[model samples]
Target: MRFKPHFEKIRFIFGAIVVVTISGCFQIFGSGPATFIKKSFNPSKTKQAILFWKGGNATSGNSLQVSIKGAGDDLDKAEVGNVFTVDDDHGKARLNPKAIRLIWKSDRQLNIEYDVNLRTFIQLKRFNDDTIVYRTFKPVIPANHMD
Candidate 1:
């Protein structure tokens, strides 16, 4: 009877440690909530483009993800079809809708424009049948010079 109480305490401590470890892993690996930034439809309105910001912890920083989906696809059910990732060292200045511009030149062509300083982690030249083109202002300073 005396040993039973001690065993129960040990089990509780072990369970708590396991839970804390799992939660810490999630914080390190998983991103925080995604905030919708902007959306645009193709000229034909058959397909849609979405831009959102996925918040991250201090280690991961914030990221901008661009996705394409059907016009009628549910925003909640659709996974983030991340075609481009703007990795500006987790800078949140570009979280606004105006920060990233998306212009559909035609049903098959898309023009994306953003700051030249922002490094693109993933830049797809094409998404499905749409040809993607990126435009940026000439960097006055070399990329390596930027802190």
Candidate 2:
């Protein structure tokens, strides 16, 4: 009777809902913890040093923090705004609006790194790929430290 039609309709809607719900859950919780890989820099003809922290471990709920250190000169006084570039391996450098901190540590070399969620970096729309590239001008180390 008419009961068959009603049952079919209900089943279709239920199936659709289940499919959508599962897909959403995968998008939300599928990605696991973020893994940060350290990149090494070589002092060569390149005045600016570029390092990238892979975003495989990045999720959709955290902010990307860029920390700079080992600059013998106070970065606050230097033109540091346009100093670095973050790309996605596709030739795009995105900027993070979060606070950038400059600290002076007695380290042998300059190191800069950041932790950012995939969602935050994706908002920039600068990268069509998944990886995020960070490029910065060579940290101004003391001449005495130069090899």
Candidate 3:
């Protein structure tokens, strides 16, 4: 499945919940006739555990191979303690910073904080083995930025 970048970038859109269940009903008769039947598929046959990466909806196993572009505009996966460059080059000066300390807030959420002469921010989702699966990146400001 292809993932399209979100307008706001990598935001989880928890939309309506659609449950699809398929079960059958059986009828039984007493003294007049004997109708013995077995019924299965009672519980929901569909898996409802779903995740969204850049507007692409996938189940737990459906997005096992998903990928996304990093803040450096390079498509990569975020693992623990991984550092990468996000330096910027202006006409006069250049700012070099590294994105590090990849932490998984949850099984499906990740928070990556970086720097560039100042601290920056990036967030993504993890599908399998804590791999980032969403795109769209910008400098994430902290609670205080004047320091």
Candidate 4:
């Protein structure tokens, strides 16, 4: 059966609305769901580091994030952190989830260790009066071959 002109226009508009609505949902929810990994507090219990992984789409890999905030602040509310990404192979990320670690070496220092190969997006050396120390067990390699 053939569709009437007005009916075809209505169907097209409805399809457009559905596409926009779904895309809006994705934007509201971010790339994908985030999973909490670990948290560590300084010796003085004043600041804390929260670790999490955020899923990514086909073009981008999963992300490992470490946020530093006041000890009492909520993890979701923490705004300052470092972000690292790894290749996304189909649905799997090229990172070993267990290879990441966070430790408080001192009241003013936070130690972060992850796979040396992951690409770092944001690396904050200092936050407020605290210092963030990042390290990988093995020698480091540049993220981009430009080096």
Model 4 TM-score is 0.66
Q: Which prediction has the highest lDDT against the true structure?
A: 1
Best by TM-score: 1
Residue 86 Cα positional deviation in candidate 3, in Å, after optimal superposition: 3.6
**Model 1 TM:** 0.78
Report backbone clashes per prediction: 0, 3, 1, 0
Q: Give every collision pair in model 2.
A: 34-57, 86-93, 87-133
lDDT of 1 by residue, 37-143 (tens): 78889999998778888776757766777887788864552244457778564442344455568888898887888766666788898987888888875444444
User: How do the predictions measure up, each by TM-score?
Assistant: 0.78, 0.30, 0.20, 0.66
Scored by Cα lDDT, where does model 3 land? 0.26
Q: lDDT scores for all predictions? A: 0.73, 0.33, 0.26, 0.68
Q: Residue 146 of model 2: what lDDT?
A: 29
Off by over 4 Å in 4: 1-29, 77-97, 139-147
Can you list the residue pairs that collide in candidate 3?
121-140
Q: What are the per-residue Cα lDDT tens digits for candidate 2 across 74-140? A: 2232122222323332312232322122221222233333323122332221222212243233223
For model 3, where is the 10-residue window of minimal lDDT?
A: 55-64
Total residue pair clashes for candidate 2:
3
